[model samples]
Target: MTDLVRARLRTTVLLIVAVLVETTLGSDLRIAGVAPDFMILVVICAGLTGGTLSGAFVGFWAGLLYDMFLTATPVGLSALTYCLIGAAIGALRTSVLQERKSLLPAAALIGTAAGVLLFVGAGDVLGQTQLLGAGRAWLIRVMIVESLWNAVLALPVGYVYAWVARGSAGAERVGSPVRRTSRSAVPTVK
Candidate 1:
């Protein structure tokens, strides 16, 4: 199989595992009444690694799968939220964000915060008043706690995502050989 296909397959497997972990163990790992969202983390990683289109595509499916396990809100809500977050991250990655050792964690911190706000805001706008029933203070608390949680987990998760996305479109391979044109083929501009 082609490398892109293999990469996609690996990513799909990772998504399934992330959802399983989120549904099974994520609830048990809450801090300050906020749980880590592995689904959003995966979508963040996809955006960081694979660019806008890939981020949106993966986000839609990931949110859809996650929606199946959710009982409170409408089915497509998460999908829309995730898709927009992923696309925003991807766009930032390509144009504004610089590559650095701390990129993943930083992105996770900011992205997760934005995601929490967007999810709740959009839900509230769409008549899901229950999302904001706890009031602004609760929302802020959840946003802060969840963003910290994701930032702490970003390194390992980002590493795995980089591995899974290897050879896929827009994935940057570490230590890849630089293409050097032969000097002899070009006329010397003496």
Candidate 2:
């Protein structure tokens, strides 16, 4: 099969696996009371590698799936939050941001934090109001811990994501060494 076709298939399957793990294994493997936010990681990866449409599409569906399984809030809230996060991160891929040192991990860290904040903020606005629930101290603690969790997860998740994309696209299967006619031959731009 073609690389593109393989990528699409892999991406779909990955999303399913992410959701399954999020609902099932996530609870079993919680450090304290927080899960790995696998769906968020997947969405971030999609945005980084697949562009806005892929990110938004995957984010919407993934978040919706999570929302459906969740007992806490309304269904569309997470969906909307992920949609925005995916779009924003995917848009950033077009700039010099990705080339900077530590850009990918930084993006993941920032994106994850933003995503969580947006989720809670939306819940608060929609009258879910978990932001103020359990008092200010608990809320701050949750934020700090979750942020740290996300930061810890960012690098490995991003690596896996890049690997998945490259593998699916067949970009990583073979190295192409350009034949040089001179000492400093630059390949022509497409």
Inter-residue clash pairs, candidate 2: none
User: What local lDDT score does residue 58 receive in model 2, on the 0 to 100 scale?
Assistant: 72
Model 1: lDDT equals 0.80
Q: List the residue pairs that clash in candidate 1.
A: none
Badly placed stretches (over 4 Å) of model 1 are 169-190
lDDT of 2 by residue, 1-190 (tens): 8766676677677778888877897677666666667788778767755556667877898898888888878989889989888777766654334344355556667788788778888889999886568776765565666666766776666665555555442222111211112212211111
* Alpha-carbon TM-score of each model against the true structure: 0.89, 0.77
Error of 1 at 181 (Å): 20
Report how far residue 166 has shifted in candidate 2, in Å.
3.4
The global C-alpha lDDT for each of the candidates, from Candidate 1 onward, is 0.80, 0.66
Model 1, 64-100: lDDT tens per residue? Answer: 9899899999999999989998888877776677656
